[model samples]
Target: MTTSAPPNPSGEDESPAAGTSTTAATSTTRRTTTVTSKVPTVTAAPTSPTTPPATQVTTSTSAAPATEIPDAPGPLSPAARLEEVGTATVDGDELVVVAPSDTARADARQGLAALEIWLNGGDPGSTWTTFAATDPTSDGWRWAAVNRRTGAVVYIR
Candidate 1:
């Protein structure tokens, strides 16, 4: 008597070919083993002989514009911008400081103190000396502290 084998779960043929492994066993018991793979199988669609392949185009949202940015303005120059305005006047080589009101004078004094602090490293010591009336020496930096808002000037040597 002959017995037939069972079908595979995936419906694919797993049986040995005809005339292959034709050795006769001593026992009637049959042990069937099926192996499954974890890898997946991919299949491409059937294309016609005269049909052309398709093209793909991609765009990026993070791309920036190619326009040029404007240049920023630099710090103001005291000599060029800070001229005699309002009550401040120029007396020969010196700047004669004359404010319109007491408030203007106070502001001018604050500006003068700021300029002095800037020149003397926050502490104006004996390094800051007044120029002589008769013979003024050109040794250190001579600056005219001008208030940009009120246009008040104070000359320092």
Candidate 2:
């Protein structure tokens, strides 16, 4: 007697036993999509020329008469011929003074020392070995040299 295999319940094709030949079926599907866009249009109306508003001028009789203003003063005179002889650094800034003679240089050094002493909250009167100008408007370093024999004094800044 001969027997055969049972049918597949999943509905899929099954291969023949051993070297037997078999055939399969294939299907294909295709689809296409399209997109559309719309742009807006703008229009402007014609413009006409416009006139400015009228202005009114009034005069006053109570104003004061104009006076001539004095001209500004000219630049200061340049310091007299001098050469750099000594320098002092204060608050990270170097202060320099020029002199024409060794005595003036010594005076400049004394002035710088006095300035440093004053900056440190000390009395600088004793440090001054020569006459120092007493100009009220002057700031920074000021030095002067006095002639011991003739009593002549020269000031340099």
Candidate 3:
């Protein structure tokens, strides 16, 4: 299903089979040039081994604007940070960690958001278990939470 252009004598591709024709364009103009150059050599007299190159030092007097350092963010309370879960919402007293949408794209920021939510006010470690698993039907990645004490699945998406 492929064809190559015919070999050309001038080294420029002029093959019509290659989707290009250069015959008229190539004959429009011609150029010729000649170049000349001269180089001179000189010998230097040897100096004493103790002689060193002169050194020059310079300093600028212009004052530069002072850069202000930004204040660091204060520490976040447990309720301010999200757990490794994607997103979280408060439903009554329970903290629900929602999985990130694959179509929307998942990344480290989402994971950090989840972690922050978990740290903030999500379920305590003793109440729920968060684990990653592959869905058997679609073979896609998923995160699920199970209530340890109740043996109930919280969310899977």
My TM-score estimates for the predictions, one after another, are: 0.23, 0.30, 0.22
Best by lDDT: 2
True-vs-predicted CA distance for residue 69, candidate 2, Å: 42
Per-candidate local distance difference test: 0.41, 0.44, 0.40
RMSD to the true structure for each prediction, in A, is 16.4, 20.1, 27.1
Query: What total of clashing residue pairs does each candidate reach?
Result: 0, 0, 17
Model 3 regions more than 4 Å off? 1-124, 135-141
Most TM-score-accurate candidate:
2
Assess candidate 1 and give its lDDT: 0.41
Candidate 1: tens digits of C-alpha lDDT, residues 66-120 = 4331121122233332322223222322333322232245455554554445454
Ranking by TM-score: 2, 1, 3
Error of 1 at 11 (Å): 99
Which rank order by lDDT, best down to worst?
2, 1, 3
TM-score of candidate 1 to 2 decimals: 0.23
Question: What would the per-residue lDDT of candidate 2 be over residues 29-123, giving only the tens digit for each residue?
Answer: 22223446677666677788897668767787886754322121112125445556566555676766444443243355555565555544566
